[model samples]
Structures are given as C-alpha cells and as structure tokens.
Target: MHKKAIYIMMLVAVLLASCSSPGRKALELSDNMLKTAPERALAILDSIENAGGLNREEQLHLVWNRAMAHQIMGMSLAEDEQLPEAIIHYREEADKQTDSYLLEASYLNWKGKRADAINVLNKGIGKIKDSTKRVKLMAEQARLLELQREYSKAAEVMERALELNPTKRDKAILNYKIGLNLSLAGDPRSEQFYSQSVRMATENGDTAMACEFLRNYADYLANNGKYRQSNNVYREISRMMPQMAGLSAIQMAMAGNYINLHMPDSARICNEKAIESEARLEAKGFDDISRRMVIELERCLLDYGDGKPVSYVGLSRYCDSITADMHAKESTLARRQEAKERLQWANHELRLDRQRMGWMLAAAVLLLLLGVAGGWIYYRNRLSRLAEAENSIDTLKRMLKETQTPAEETPEEKQQKSEDDAFFKKILLQQLGIIRMVASTPTNHNQALLKRIAGISEGKIQTDSLLVWPDLYLVIDRLYDNFHNRLTERYGNVLTEKEIQIACLLCAGFSTKEIGVVTQQSDATIYVRKTSIRKKTGAAEGQDIVSYINGIKAD
Candidate 1:
C-alpha cells in the first residue's frame, strides 16, 4: 500500500510539471506580447528549440504565434511567399479563418495593395463568426482607412470594433484613436470621445496616457477658439506634469491661449516660464532651432497685443504664406476624399440594382404561376358547363319523341301548340340567362333577377299573376301535351303547394339541391318533400320521381 501511494504522488507531480512546461509558458508570453511588441514576440517564438515533446494544441498554437508575429512585424514566413502555406496549416475553423484573413490582408498591405487588403478584410469580417477575430480584422481595416485619409470612415469602423467586446485597455485605446480621427475629420464630436478616453485611462490607472490625452484635448480646444476651456485642461495636465514630457511646449501653448484671451500680462508670464524651460533643455544638450523660433514668435505676438508701434509687414507676409500652404494641403486632401466617396457610392448603387433585379424576377415568376393555375380552373369549368348543355339537349329530344305522334291536327290546335311552344322556350331561355348572370357576376341586381325567376316558377309573385306558374299552366300543359296538368289534378288534393313546386322543378331536370336553392329551402327538406310526394302519388319504390310524373297522363 505504501508503494502504491508513492507511485500516485509521483504521477501527480509529473502531471503538474507537464502542465507548466517551459514551452507552454513561452507560448503564452509571446501571444500576450504580439500586439504590443511583435519583434520581441517573434524572437521569443524563435527560441523554442524543441517542439516534439509538446502536445498537438501546443504545437498548433506555436505555429499560429509564429505566423501572427511575422505578419505583425511586416515580414514574411518565407522570403518567396510561403506565408499562405503556413496560414492554412491551422485546423480549427475560427482560428484558420482569422489567421488566413488577417495574414493575407497584412501581406497585401505590405506589398502596397491597400485596396485589395481592405476587400479581403471586409470579406473576412462578413464570414468570420468569432467576435474576437472580427474585432481584429476591423482594427486592421480601420488602419488602412486611416492611411487612405478617410478619417470619418476610419472613426466609424473603430466605433464598430469597440462593440465587439475588446479588453479594457484596447477599448481605451480605441476611444483615443476614434477621437484622433474625428479631430482630423473636423467633426465637433471629437471632444466627447477625447473626454471619454481621458476618463477611461484615468480609471485604468494609466496616468501618463491620461495626461497625453489631455494635452491633445487641450490643443483641440485652443484651435477651435475655446481658450478658457483649453486653459482648464492644461491646468489638469499640469497636475500630472512630473510624469509627462514636453513642459516647454505646454507652457508655450498656454501662453498662446492667454494671448488669445487678451491677458497680455499672464501671456508674458507664461512666455518667460517657457523661455526658462527651453534654456534648461538647451543646458541638457537637447535643444532645437525650432524651439527658439517659436519662442521669438510668441514674444512678437505679445508685443503686437500690447499695442507696440512697429513695422509688421514681414510678419504679415510670413503668416499669409504659412496660411496659404496649409490651405493648399487641405484642398488637395478634400479632392482626393471626394473621388473616393464617389467610387464607393457607385459600388453601393450597383449592389442595390442587383438586389432589385432579383426581387423583380421572383415577382414575375410568382405572377406567371398564378396565371397558369387560374387558366386551368376556367377551362375545367367551361368543359363541365358544355357537358351539362349537351345532356339538356338530349333530354329535350327524348321528350319530343315520347310525346309527339304522326296524326294530323286541326289548325286551331296546331296554332295553339306552336304559340305555347314558343312562349315556353322564351321562359326557359330567360331562366338560363338569369342563372348564367348570377354565376358569372353575383351582383345584387343579378341576384334579385334570379330570385324573381324563382318566385315566378313557385307562383309566389302575386302582383303579376299572369307571370306565375299556375297562370302559365296552360302553356306548360300544351308544351307537355297536358301531362303536367293531369299529374297535378290527380295529386293536388294530397300535395302541398311547396311539394308541387319541387315536383315541377324536378320534372324540369333540376336536382334536389338546385330546387332547394330556387325555393330557398334546405336540401334535406327538399328530399323529405320528394319522399312524401312519392308516397302520396303511389309511385313504386326505386323509381325516379321525374319519370313517374312523366308517366302520369290521367287519374
């Protein structure tokens, strides 16, 4: 048992030793330093002599660090373009995509193909799912945009990068860079960003960085005619002056602000302090001619502000020349930016046109499908109606053959028969027209006409008694050779008026459901009425009601 316990202890120690191995420690260190000091990271990564003992993850990590370090340092993995081969060696998809995009973009940028580099980064930003990798790519893109003098676009991209959840230090740095870009773009919002950056740096315990940020913010205020606010920021920087550099420059800027505020005495005091600081710097053998020139210019400004009468043509000419040079540079930058904006707008418009064409094509295809479906339905309905018409014609022929004979008739009877046939045909054609109109249009007028026809057939329109079915019974009697008259005469005592109407509709070749619609009754009621009629008329079971009515000639 003691030997077993000792073996367990040894195993535990071996695991701990492997977990904190020297190569793994160096990998972590190099990765941390990749953004801050790429050259140092590359040297540390190169010092790894033996990677054979490392695990697979450690090995992949080693390769990734080397590739990234070289890219950051603006060098290639191989002098002859073997960098892409190294990039694809990563197996994990997110890491592989990140390295491939960032490495390629960096390579292109180094080769003086900044536009292609931006395109590659944009593609990667769209395709990469990892937020960290997207942030890295955006940072590179922002760098390229800055190089192209597109300060507004650069600031916009940096704002997007901050939303990707970078580290606190990175967020502070991003705010500072965004402020710098906005200041270059001549946007007033840069003051807000600068203030935010200073606040964040102070909270992060970066005093030197905070003071540096305050210096720039003060300069921006002074340039924009906010001399009082600029003086306040300068005082804030003076609180941290021991940790800051360029005291002489700060004093000169304060003197300019005082001079702008028309406080000549305060301006003279600041100028004297600046001269003293400059002398001290010169004593340290770190002096420049520009510092003396700037100090003399401040003295001249103080003399002019004090209303000293002096010849000032040389100073005016020198100031004009400097202002003209600044304006020329600004105008050139504006034209270049305008051209770039036009190109970007053209590309955006082309993409929008492609999307619009796709939507139009989809809409056209959908319309065509609907049209085909509607045409098919219409054709089927027309064929059904034609078949119904042919069956109706056959029924008329069969009735004529069953009822007509070859015997001669008197002229009076023949004329009466011909008039009844013409009148009945006219009524039938009017009924068919009303039904067809209702089927096609279903307007209120057409529906009213259909109901009026139904009322006429049911003998319900009392105001026009001659139009009722019973009043027209003479014409129907002659048309059917008095067969319908005899059937009603025999069964009229037992049948209701509703039942008689249903019987008339049935003999006219209307189905039970159609009869119900004409009479405004349910189909079940129509079926019950038909059964009652069959019983009362003594018709045999399994015989059709219409055929039974036709067979009845006399009681």
Candidate 2:
C-alpha cells in the first residue's frame, strides 16, 4: 500500500507540472511567427491541440492566445484593405475571446453592424477589468446609445468614460462627445462641457476642433437670445478659421438672430450679405443648388417681411416640399449603405433572424390600427363635448361681432374693459364658493335646502365641465375683450371653447389649469382637453400648449 501511494504521488506531481507546458510551447511558437509567417504558426497550434496536455486553466489561456493570433490576422487583412476577410477574422477572434469588447465592436462598427456591436458590447462590457478596455467599451456603448436616441443615457456613459481617460487630448475628445449628448438631451450643463472641451483642445494645439466647438458655443448663446455674445464667438471663429467653407450659413443664422431681436432692418442687411456670400461661393465653383435654396429661403422670409402673405405662404410650402424630398433621398441612401455593409458582418449573424419581415410587418400594422382606433375614439368623444360648448359661445360671439365695428377706442371702451374684467373675476369667485358650499353642506335635507337657496345648487350641482361649462364659456367669451375674434382669426375657428378659454386666461397672464375651480371640471379632464387643444391648434413641435396659448393676441 505504501509503495502504491508513492507511485501515485509521483505521477500526480509530473501531471501538474506538465498541465500548461504543451499549450505554452504552442503559444510561444505562434507568437514568434506572428510578425512573419502566422499561418505556419497557426498550423503548429492545430497540431498541438489534440496532444492533450493542458488543464482547464491552460485551456482558457490557449483560447486567449488563439484570439490574439486571429486579431493579428485580421489587422494584416485590414491593412491590405480586405475588409470582408478582416471582419470575418475579427468575428472569429471575438467569439474565442472574453476580455475585450472594444476590438469586436470596432470591427462591427466598420461594417455598420450597430445591432451586432450592441449585442457584443452588452455581453462583454460588464466583465471587463482593465481600465483602458473598460473606457473604450463605455465610449462605444455611449455611441450606440446616441444612435438609439437615448441621449441622457449616452451622456452618463460618456461621463464614466471621461473618468477613465486621464490624458488631456483623449479627455478633450470625450468631453466634446459628452457635450454633444448633453446638448441633445436638453441638459443645461451642456455649455460647461463644451467650454471644457474647447479649453483642452486649445491646450492640445487642435485649433480646428477648438474652432468647431466655438461655433457651437456661439449657437448656444444665440439660441438662448444672447445675440451680441453669440456674434463675438462668431467673430472668434472667423479669426481662427479664416478660409472655412460654409461661413455664409452663419450669416444666414445671424440674420435670423437679428429678426428675433426685433431688428428687421438689420436682418435685411445681414440677409443681403448672406445672399452675396452664397453667390460668391457659387462663383468659386460651389454647387448652385445649395445657394439657390438659401436664396429661395431668404426670399420667402423677405416676402413675409414685405407683407406679401400669399406669395410668402406659397413659396414657403414649395421650399418645404422640396426640402422634404431631399431629406427622404438622403435617408434612403443611408439605409442602402447600411444594408450593404451589414451583409459583410458575420458576428452572431443568426441571433436576430427569428422574426421574419412578414411577421414584423403584420405586428406593426396591428399595433398601428389599434392605436389609431383608440385615439380616434378618445378624441372624437373629447372634441364633441368641447364643440358643444364652443358652438353655444360662437353663436353669442357672432351676434357681438355683428353689432360691433372697427373704430378708435373711447373712454367708455376702457371703462367697459375694466367692468367686464371685474364681472369675470366675480363669477369665477362665485363658482368656487358654490363648489365649496356644496361640498361642506350638511347631509340633512333642510340644511342642503338652505345651501341650495343660497345659490349653491346643493346635491344637484353639476361637477363635469362638459355638463356645466357652456354658461361659463359664454360669460368668459363675452367678458374677455377681443379674445373670441382674435383667436378665431388666428386659428380660423379651429379653437374649441376650452382652448379659447385657456388662450384668454393665458393672454391675461393667468396660470390656466383645470376648469373645475371656475366651471366644475376635474384637473385631469382639463389637462386632456388642453392636449387636444394643442393638437387642433397645430402647436409647433416641442412647444407646450400653454406657450402657444399665451402667444395668441387678444386684440
């Protein structure tokens, strides 16, 4: 028994020492020929695979080494511009390796395989340990997030990457990306990152990127209504990149800024300079199509300024239609390029193949139909109630308009305005008092009768705006001077009573909310009414209903 134990111990010791030896030898041979003849080294690796001398840990190391070899093979192929072959090798490397997702995602990005890159990054990013590798993966992930339009999430990821990039130039690049994502996310701190990025790029002697950053900085200032400061930055851009192409576009923007600042005279002069610059560009061999478009746009604005409404509207629609077509063509071209490149990508290519086009199309159509049906039902019911109230008010307003005439205001006109405003506030206060009296009135019949006698309507009081608001609508329409006529003209009778009420209140600088306080409607119900009002009034994208309402002129 003692002799047998000694023999087993000696056998185990030799096996343990030899566990990783054979794989190491194979790896060393592959590494030596990596710069010279890699295929021969790969063949040596194949030969040693079945020699069966490696333990589990050694097998892992072997995979790591093999992944490195495949990466080198891909790099050489890429150097020769053999992109498809290179991508295939990169996919092979990525499949065998577990450490780096950045390398895998880069090749996928090269092939425009964004979904495949997302999958690879999602799988590998969490397991990464090396700071550099983790940083690269985070940055790539942020780019993918941006493509998905998850701008805030992308900014967060870029912030993490920013922490890992210690070098000034690298951090500067990351900071620029952070600013881009934050700006798109509509965060207020986007300017801070933009400033940091510009400072760092200046320190790194990258004048080109710094100038680009300054251009955007100027745009931020201009968008926030700071025209003089924005012009200062624009002047800085000219000093930096004197020969920069497309500076004429900035002149067009400056013209817009002047228009917003209520300086149409200055706007006209700036627009002339823009048109001249664009004409110069056309003379210097630039395409006439772009310059012609700019000229047409300027002409449309000028027509509006010159009070040629009919011509301006027609030309504006023409310009919009042509611009839409151009964008559609550009989108189609982008899709074609993406599809072509996707065909060359081979990483986990079958993962997204489960759903067919027919299935996806059917599912999408079903969802769209259901959504349209639900939306139509909701809006139909909501609008019907609103239209009823407005119809009653509209009849009264037509009578008022027929009686009134356009004339210079007298002191009686001013007195009527004050008296009407007082009456409107008194009615609103009385409405609130009625609601509170009804709520706080005792359940006893005599007490409720007393409340009802006091003009509270008691237990029979209507709380729904659709049920009780028609009277209130007529009163508000009559009391608010010129609200009904002005709103009808602006939106062409599309404004419902609820929307008109909101608009009148907003014009009066009132924080309009639920009509329950004034006409017994629930806050949520009124909010839905406001949403429908916005859609019907054609509020511009990103504009809130209240802002649109407040912009309506009462006179």
Model 2 is weakest, by summed lDDT over 10 consecutive residues, at: 451-460
**Highest lDDT against the true fold, candidate:** 1
State the local distance difference test value for candidate 1.
0.72
Residue 69 CA displacement from its true place in model 2, Å? 20
Q: What is the C-alpha lDDT of each candidate?
A: 0.72, 0.62
lDDT, candidate 1, 468-541, per-residue tens: 66744565666666656777788889998888777766655556645554454556888788889889998877
Clashing pairs in 1: none
Model 1 misplacement above 4 A:
1-81, 88-100, 240-246, 275-296, 299-555
lDDT by residue (tens digit), candidate 2, 60-160 = 44454454455556542122233333333444353433334654565565567778877888766666655666676777788888988999998898787
Candidate 1 TM-score, true structure as reference? 0.41
Query: What's the C-alpha lDDT at position 19 in model 1?
Result: 40
Best by TM-score: 1
